[model samples]
Target: MVSDFRKKKLLHVFTSFFDRNGSGSIDKKDFELAIENISKLRGWSSGDAKYVETQSALLKIWEALQSRADSDKDGEISVDEWISMWDEFAKNPSAPLEWQNLYSKFIFNLEDASGDGVIDGEEFSSVYESFGLSKSDALVAFKKMSKGKGQVSWSEFQELWKEYFTTEDVAAPGNFIFGKTSF
Candidate 1:
């Protein structure tokens, strides 16, 4: 089960990414702005291959978020909807198994920068860095998850992703998925 503190941390991470305008909600515009922001961070020009790839992945994530959190069918996700989704996950995370799986798969694909269906240390580190984790903290988490392996496979990644969202263990490597949270 997810602890209250962990739940709050996850919510904070989600809000940080999705609430681009700091408007307490995620709408299409905010989602698009997030894509542009990441594109700039990665130094992707409009016609670059990597830019296209990034846009594709962002679109997938955007659609998934809207499908899951747009409860009013109004094309926007209110803060209530966001919290409700988290509460539902906290209560019975498996209830939204399909969405979770799809979201995780999208993340895995995005992180597989080599297109090899695996996350190498650098790729894993990038994921952690995106959440503002320090390099040392990310390395520690990667080492823990990899267990001496040079890379983490899709199965392992999926397991870690689920644990990060569902488990309350403070020391779980997955707990570091979003850097450290003050609980």
Candidate 2:
């Protein structure tokens, strides 16, 4: 956990990131911009990192934001709502999730969409449709994830997760845009 002082600093920085306009509040676009900025800084691939746009991971983030921001039927986040969400985050920072396990489970869940622990194209497509991603995304992910010549096994998924998630900056990884920051 971060100290209150650090959390406060994080809050300030995050709010600044979210407050794109001079209105001193966050709208959906501002939040999306913040997500985009994080990807820039973190060197996250479009598929690896999430934005407010539709994607499996993004859906989860948006769900949390909806619970926090979509109050009073405004479909937008007021300053108060933004502060409330910020406070919630300060009080309980999201645990640093392990990406390897996360990626594995993501594929497995897609494979086992029916909850029977089996994978089919139909099931994988369900997860893809949920994220507005194409079935080709899964195919590509699988192709890269697969180590053996023929088919991908669960173990191969882990290797793919590491290689994809742990690229040495975005340039080292494909399909990632790079940004330069000054010291």
Candidate 3:
């Protein structure tokens, strides 16, 4: 989360994470769970997460939120507290990780709305507005991710990201998105 674009990217990922959750919030325990998963994902495999989100995940996300969250000097968090934290993060997705955690706390125990073990084309499509991805772009992303049907796993996410996410924030691609994103 360095440049404006990276912040945008982080927000994109964050929004999706929040949307997938039934309550739209997360606590320390929830944050730890996400890190646990990321930690387990030691290596990449056919699109699997580079890291499953264990210590790495917790530390990263918490660092990301440190700036605005952690309101109480206590250090632990609750679901409501987390929601408020993410809201601020959403407003400034690229702010300093001075108070945030890059990989750990932000993405643990993600509540997949689709119940598919991962976010899917339909899920992403539904959430595109929050991510700032156009329906068309989201559709394109969905198509590439689905490759057919079902939810898009983290491994598949890598491939899809490479496709939809530009190599650089250099130039906007022509017709960035095409077709329709459907369930």
The candidate scoring highest on lDDT is: 1
Which candidate number would show the highest TM-score if scored against the true structure? 1
Model 1, residue pairs in steric clash: none
Which tens-of-lDDT digit does each residue in 15-57 have in candidate 2?
5434655466555566455456545543556776232232445
The TM-score values for the models, in the order shown, are 0.77, 0.33, 0.33
Better of 1 and 3 by lDDT: 1
Clashes of each: 0, 0, 34
Instruction: Please give the CA lDDT of all the candidate structures.
Output: 0.69, 0.43, 0.43
Model 1, range 11-123, lDDT digits (tens) per residue?
A: 66667667778877777787678667766756788788877876776777778878887899988888667767766775765566455666678667756767898887787
lDDT of 3 at 42: 31
Candidate 1 vs. true structure, TM-score: 0.77
